[model samples]
Target: MNWLLVVVGGMTGAPLRYLTDRAVQSRHDSVFPWGTFAVNITGCLILGALTGAALAGATGSHLQLLLGTGLCGALTTYSTFSYETLRLAETGARFYALANVAASVAAGLGAAFLGVMLARAVWG
Candidate 1:
């Protein structure tokens, strides 16, 4: 059952990752990987909200199974981030790669924190 949820979440998450990549890529002019940035930030916010909801005792395991295991699991992507970073490294774009690594983690975490705070304040 849990494996099934993971698979379903992956399905949604992978496509979301791809769609967001395309959407951001279409609007950005730099090779700085705005798609990745957008997706990770959004994912962070969502995960944070989920965490907040879980903590508040406002939800149940089935909800967690869907949101935590499915939605969030799909939303937060590590593989694409790794692949892009590696591509940058292999292409002699060391600085850009490092920036992506730092920015993704820092911004993602920041967004997650903000989301948690926002949900807590608003919903509670």
Candidate 2:
């Protein structure tokens, strides 16, 4: 049952990630990988909310396995982030590379924290 949930979550998350990436990338015209950044931050927010719900006893392992492990795991792409950073540096967009790292980390963390706080307020 747990595995099934994870599989279903992954199946949903993967395409969502790809479609979301494409949609975001299409809207932007820059070397910066906005798509990956957006998805990663979104995933962090979702996972954080799930964690807060779990902490508040509003969620259980099944939800964790489905959304946290499967959905978030598929939705966020650390590998793409790393690759884009490297590509930017190699292509002489070193500033963008550093900025991407800085912004992604800062925004992702902030989003996750905010999500947790929001969920705790709602569920706790």
Please name the candidate that would achieve the greatest TM-score relative to the true structure.
2
C-alpha lDDT score of every prediction, in listed order: 0.82, 0.94
- Per-residue alpha-carbon lDDT of model 2 for 1-124, expressed as tens digits? 8999899889988999999999999999898999999999999999989989999999999999999999998999999999999999999999999999999999999989988998999998
TM-score of each: 0.86, 0.98
Score candidate 1 by lDDT.
Answer: 0.82
After the best TM-score superposition of candidate 1, give how far the Cα of residue 123 lies from its true spot, in angstroms: 3.1
Q: How displaced is residue 6 in candidate 2, in Å?
A: 1.1
**What is residue 58's positional error in candidate 1, in angstroms?**
1.5
Q: Put down candidate 1 lDDT per residue, 8-73, tens digits, no spaces.
A: 877888788888889998998877778987888898888788778777777777767776778777
Q: What value does the lDDT take at residue 39 in candidate 1?
A: 83
